[model samples]
Target chain A: MALRVGVVGGGQLARMMIAPAVELGVELRVLAEAEGMAASAAATAVGDYRDAETVVAFARDVDVLTFDHEHVPQEVLAALVDAGIPVRPGPGPLRFAQDKLAMRARLAELGMPQPDWAAVAGADDLGAFLAAHGGRAVVKTPRGGYDGKGVRVVRDPDDAADWFEAAQGAPLLVEELVDFSRELAQQVARRPSGQMRAYPVVETVQRDGVCAEVIAPAPHGGDRLSAVAASIGTAIAEGLDVTGMLAVEMFETTDERLLVNELAMRPHNSGHWSQEGAVTSQFEQHLRAVLDLPLGTAEPVAPWTVMVNILGGPEVGDIDGRFAGVMSEHPSAKIHTYGKASRPGRKVGHVNVSGFDLDDVAYEARAAASHFD
Target chain B: MALRVGVVGGGQLARMMIAPAVELGVELRVLAEAEGMAASAAATAVGDYRDAETVVAFARDVDVLTFDHEHVPQEVLAALVDAGIPVRPGPGPLRFAQDKLAMRARLAELGMPQPDWAAVAGADDLGAFLAAHGGRAVVKTPRGGYDGKGVRVVRDPDDAADWFEAAQGAPLLVEELVDFSRELAQQVARRPSGQMRAYPVVETVQRDGVCAEVIAPAPHGGDRLSAVAASIGTAIAEGLDVTGMLAVEMFETTDERLLVNELAMRPHNSGHWSQEGAVTSQFEQHLRAVLDLPLGTAEPVAPWTVMVNILGGPEVGDIDGRFAGVMSEHPSAKIHTYGKASRPGRKVGHVNVSGFDLDDVAYEARAAASHFD
Candidate 1:
């Protein structure tokens, strides 16, 4: 029988996995939230992931269960585990990704480098955190937060008064504002058998808190930086017991120190460049990992690879309308779309370009992506 | 609406197209001959491709029609075109692929070099050809033949007596067997607008008339040979007014001449290496060509890429049973499996490896494929 993998959530991540699953001859079934989602092609069950019965039913026929996002409630995950469903990045590890407060606390226990953080229950607690961090801090909701949502910068406790009230005594996460030169992301894949592979660290360019571009191996990263990033990524995957793909977003300080900024227990935007740049793409690796197959090599196929996302897509028409123009001008650029409608700030698609010259690859990727604007 | 492509057969070629179609956000629908075919994941219609009514119904929702193999009947194709559906590699060009005798005659008319051949009506005609060509020749049924079927080498005219009796006065195709040192295949993609891109010619190793291995760019092929191969491929595609992908199988004789041997008007086994080796895979290029979109570059991603077919899978179990061992042993080899039952001589999967060293790539690909045996 072909290995069957059940994925919860039908976002672009789930859509991207369909390609590798088809190539690997694995049967992938998605539990999309609704019809017409990006991953509708593979979605077999449509229901809320929060309902234990719905998730348990979705996992019945699959050999293992994984995620498109880390938002499946712990209660629903517990039910699946009780039913003997093998969930990669089990609830124990997923809690950290779903809640920033838990992730910070766990990283502290693991001795990973990260900014100072506190769980603030009220204005008094928030005031203390702000005052201790140059009177500036980042406040966040511990649950259901993604992209730039549920996050805010605060100079005064009043900046997050609404969040404090909404928390209703549940502590909100607040962290010291990080002063960094740039952002970087390190990706690692780990099989249930404990085998692991790390991709090179990539420099990410974000606009309005959304990833705009990424450069594989991070130009000028040097041996030490690459090694450090990989080591940190490996350490996190092991420490968190991440069984599928893990992405660690970090801040490169002015002093060259790497501090954890965020964690994704699934394929992240930073590694999208690997689709054409690396020997084994993250999507393929994730499938292998979830199925407990031996991990593949994560070596880069070229010296450089650049990825630029097509945010919002074309204003007046679908992304498909721009294919002729973009494809004509950039023959080597690999364009990937999510089958989603255009909405301002939405990640509709991306273009990846790989070659020996970093400048040319980056320019080509950006130019090809610009057509969707 | 996404660009919908209707493939007329449910085979491995159509199965491989699923990956690129999903990645490109193009909708691919296949008309399978039966339920649970290799391309069942995308098989939206299960019907006979030879039936004009069945094929025309399948083409109703798609923007353009193409093939997984060159076996669709001309009447079915004519029906689709008559209904205003776009059929790539239209009936005019597909007849050459459907009938070897027609292809030979057309190539001869175009002044292309090929083995000395003739349409023999009886034993007398066959005897004369054999007597003039070292008392040996090859006879083919000219239709419904693939992978050694319907073809035979003959030293005596009576060796094909049964075939001649079955022909019922219809001429059989007979050719002088050319003593060749190696076999090669060239692939070219042309859009409906006439723009074309040619991939590097590759060397193919055939076992029992079935493709066993392929080496991209044909190691030891000088610039002259590559140019000649590309030119021939381009000429065949343009001369036939073929749209989409075209594969031209050729023989490199001991005296240094490239002679056309066979023609395939869809993604062929010879170009499978391009799935990982080239900047644009033939399946993706075929889709773009049929849609009349600008074609992507066909440059090789590495110095060499070797592909080895996995025939008949395992003796006891399915191909999935061997994945762990093969993956652990050859982490860099890309394994692609077609969801099909194991049968002797049946192509169940393939392995692709690409690198700077041709020897290493070939060794890795062969080693990985051997695990299936």
Candidate 2:
């Protein structure tokens, strides 16, 4: 019997999964919004993500419902779960991911360490948050923020005063712009049967607020930090009853404290290192976890693995030369190109390098993954 | 523009090439017997390998001509080349691969060390050959023999009564049985531009005339054996002006001699170790070599890597349990299952495992790939 998986979006993550899913004999059905999308499964039923009827019908033919993105409406997700479809990171848990304020409120109740934050309804609320944290505070809309979009460090309330008035009217979250040393992410997989596994915590570098690179085992390594991050990731999965892959993006502060920055319940870009670095690639592990086919080994293939994101900046034209140079120079580096068109700051692809010298690989890996237009 | 690859056969090698070709953005077009074959480029023109007209038409559309098997008639291949299609391992070179007598003649002319051998067309010639190499000799059809098929060992002349009576005369080759300790394979890739690269010699174990397992960086730590085998493989590829992959199956004699037994021009089963063990997989390297793209690194990903073939012997039912059990136990083992139905001694699939422990992983990998039945 073939296990059917219905993905809600048609992007590269879904596209990359096609190879492994087909190889594993798993039936992958995609309810993509557009035709000619990468990784569009053969069982694809093209439809709009905004349409609940299309989504529900797509779910009907699948054994399990998963996602390629978190853009689906809560109402649509609830409709699927209401009809008895086994959706990973079920609506109850996904709501926390969709609504940042609700997530902060819930996590606050759970006693997790995040930055000091407050929900702001208007300029007055923003002013109050600014007063509590420093004079400057980071303002983020409760929904639809990714890769630095919908996020701003506003020194004055007048900056987004008019736009915030017309948008979703959803309460915004305001936090102090912490002076962080670096950012890190923890990738974990969980099964409905309560089995769980976590990969090593990796330090991520952000450029223009988008992930530019990641260093595994976190620079200035400490076994305790890995344990702490893994424990937190496990607690989140168990506490939320989350199923499948989850990536908890964290901020490692100057004092060595790890703070939750954001959460993703699918294969995230931060976990890309595992594709060539770990015993099992994050893509395969996500498929295994989603199918409940048993999680794979998470041991690192090398002592150190560094991943660098290839941003589609002004350097896009250098893809060809860079690829050749990287292949020739750092022969050990594993480069993964997403076959995407270039756009400023858009993620086009990435490169991973594994060796004993983590820092050296990180330097070479960044150069390898970065486009040179 | 997509790079066009012309494959000569639509068998499993072509089928396996589809995945990597698609990933590497090569347009694969096979000259198969019929449509609906497993390779990405299934033959659209229904014809025979002996028909030069059909093969020429197939080659016209493809940028480069390679092969899935060595069975294509030499005259047909030469005709296509004369018509100006770039047939890799050109007709003159491929003839050496097709006929054992041609290969042996060339090897002996090149002063390469191989088993003492001779070709016989009749009983008189066979008797003289047998007399020269003891009373016992291995009788082979010289052409159309593979997988322990059509080759036999016999002591008495009466044992040759049947083959001799049937011989009404096709060419045949007789050679002294090699008293070797173990068998090994050296895989190498050569480009049309005269660039060549060789992977470490891998120890291969055959059972029931079929390849059962291959271990890379051959166990017992014989660095000299590996170097010699690699040199021999490189020499053959260069000597034959071969473009694409060349697999040299060699017998490591107890007297410390590496005797060339057979050769495969395309990606061979022996190179499966590159999937997980080497920095670049053989499939990927074959695509690169055929496309004239710069080759990738051939360094091993780990110190030890083992590969085991899954022979779907007749009468074995229910492979799901064994597959799932192995997956559950060895979460890190890279398994490749060709979606072929179970049949006696068929090459259904193979499992490649890599780690620090060669013997332990080899044991587990063989167990996982072998039939549970």
Number of the top candidate by DockQ? 1
lDDT of 1 by residue, B181-238 (tens): 9999999999989999999999999999999999998988999999999999999999
lDDT per residue for candidate 2 within B141-164, as digits (tens), equals 767778898788866655566776
How far is each candidate from the true structure, as Cα RMSD in Å?
1.0, 2.9
- Per-residue CA lDDT of model 1 for A122-167, tens digit only, reads 9999998888889999999998888888889999999998988888
Q: Which stretch of 10 consecutive residues in model 1 chain B shows the poorest summed lDDT?
A: B312-321
Candidate 2: tens digits of C-alpha lDDT, residues A65-180: 88888889988988898888888868877887887888788878878889999887788888877777778988888788888888889888766686468665767888778878
- Per-prediction TM-score: 0.99, 0.92
| Alpha-carbon lDDT of model 1 | 0.93
